[model samples]
Target: MDTLLSIFDVKLAIENLPFVLSGLPMTIAVAFLSMGVGALLGLFLALGRGSSYRLLRWPTRIYISFMRGTPILVFLYVLYLGLPEVGIELTAFQAAVIGFGLNSAAYIAEINRASLNSIDTGQWEAATTLGIPYWRTLGGIILPQAARIAIPPLTNVFLDLTKATSLAAVITVPEMFQKAQIVSGRSFDSLTMYITVALIYWPLCIVISAFQERLEKRFSRYVNE
Candidate 1:
């Protein structure tokens, strides 16, 4: 009970919240951008991995393997530091978006590939019989179905990305975690400030989880029925 913080302390944590909330817009922008970039690149990577051509397949396989196998923090450093040597200068926040998005793509690609594989072989044959191009068949026939199968894993990846945003503090993106650190360092109320940030994340996670459930139900209803 002694460690329990007071209402004044918690209120102090939020009173000057506008500055912290300003950083929130950047956090949201990074997340949505990450999801968009991640999903598109992941879709192609998944397709390439599933391709019949050795040239197309092997490289993507290696790329996905490397990304998935490595830690994202390591990836972040390489992109932020190593890329600068090659004339790529991303601001810290930009680098975070790119790194987290790329990391997410690797996992999402695997999820998509697995979902695509789960479809009956006959669906491909049927699409071919209808004179649909292979790519069209994939887009119109397969991907929507694959999307349903991919939802749970995709949701999990988004959650991971959301949490992983804390790492932005390392490169100084001034996100929630970084804000907490700044506040704690100033007030010496380390526990109280971090507790507020922790509180913020929990509700966001729950909302995303709830949406994921609704998406799962909507998709399942179509296929299962």
Candidate 2:
């Protein structure tokens, strides 16, 4: 109790707060940026993953397999460090964002594919009866439903990305973990510094989880009622 309370001292940590908060914008920016990129790429990946034709599916499968199979650390290292050796230099932040975004795309693709599949087959048939084009029917009828199913897992991915941002520390992105390291170095209080960072992480995730629940309830209304 004492240790926890000690770490939560707003007054003592007040000066430290701005430094921590400074990194937050970047953290959140990278998170949202990555999610946006991941979602766009993932949409295609999901489509390809569920594609009926082998020609279309194989390439997508290979990309997903390669990304999902590799460690994120290894991916980052290759992009940020190794690529420079091959004369393809990238900024650490850019490399980290791309690496993590690409990885998240693989997982998001599977989530989207699963969610797309979860929609009732009759929903598609109903759209067919309306003489809607396939793409139009998907946009107008199917996607909204799939989005609801996907939201919970997508939020789960958000939480994961939030935590994974810590990996940016390894590459000196000046994010929360990096700030913690700097403060810990100065205060020689690594324990307190990290505990505070952990506290911030926990609450953000809890909020995401709460919002996910609310969204699910709202979307389920057409059926539950």
Worst 10 residues of 1 by lDDT: 1-10
User: Across residues 31-113, which tens digit of lDDT does each residue of candidate 2 receive?
Assistant: 87888888889989999999999988999999999999999988888998999898999987898789889999999999999
Candidate 1 wrongly placed segments (more than 4 Å): 6-8
Instruction: Return the TM-score for each candidate structure.
Output: 0.92, 0.88
Q: How well does candidate 2 match the true structure in TM-score terms?
A: 0.88
lDDT for model 2: 0.85
Can you write out model 1's per-residue Cα lDDT over 1-225, one digit (the tens) per residue?
544655338576777466566667767777778888899999999989999999989999999999989998888888777799999898888889999888889898999999999999899999889899998998878887888899999999998888788888878887888887887788878777777777777888899999999998888864875
The collision pairs in model 2 are none
Name the regions of candidate 2 deviating beyond 4 angstroms: 1-14, 221-225
lDDT of 1 at 190: 77
